[model samples]
Target: MKVFSICHVSIVMLSIIIISTNLMIPFYTVVAAETNCSNGDIVIAQSRVGTLPSGIPSFSVEITNACARGCSISNLHLKCGMFASAVLVNPKIFKRQDVDDCLVNGGSPLAAGSTISFKYANSFQYPLSLASATCG
Candidate 1:
């Protein structure tokens, strides 16, 4: 009777472990998917190229999608305060929405490892910051 009871307890413990592990698999999967990318994965780099004909400083800006999991990012918004350029920057590439909000790529998706670059002339380089993005 004692040996039977011990075997039964061991079997019950093993079953409980297996069931719990199985239930946790989906939860872990969902969490991993959700964490694959974020706004931090978008990298912005700006460098002073040269002076424009108007004497304003020209800067080259490069925006890169650096998602580790090869995810795509879209609807990218940047924190650009009073963003303006003396030189023409295609509105389709970058445009201001509000006093401190600017949209990139006309709200289109930037594929993983892809980069979008543009030039702007301003008295000083505007500090562009990644404010928000959607990852897929």
Candidate 2:
């Protein structure tokens, strides 16, 4: 009876460890779900606007955490189908390409009120036609 109880406890603990690993993917330490940068969370989003092809404009965006607590931002992807738009216009624009880590000193974790920036360039022909952008 003692050996059976011990094995049962071990199995339960193993199951819990596996479950926690799966949960971490969604609730990991990058961007917590309860974290809202838009709703008065002492957060800020900014971008530097630039133009390409003399007619097309692009924005390099950044999201900063201004609060004391650490936050994770999961599912934080750029607008959908925006990559095709860049390919059609310039064939080289990427919305979420691996930017150089220089902004954060080669993967330095950002502290409270610290910022993370990403750069994306967009360009189109002289006559600009909407090519299905996910960003506003």
The candidate that achieves the highest TM-score relative to the unseen native structure: 1
Candidate 1: residue 61 Cα off by (Å): 0.2
Give the range of the ten consecutive residues with the poorest summed lDDT in model 1. 1-10
Question: What pairs collide in candidate 2?
Answer: 30-72, 30-73, 31-72, 31-73, 32-72
Model 2 scores worst on lDDT over the 10 consecutive residues at 1-10
Give lDDT per model, in order. Answer: 0.79, 0.33
Q: Which segments of candidate 1 are over 4 A away from where they belong?
A: 1-35
Q: What is the C-alpha RMSD of each candidate to the true structure, in Å?
A: 14.5, 16.4
- Which candidate number has the best lDDT? 1
lDDT of 1 by residue, 58-87 (tens): 999999998776777878889999999998
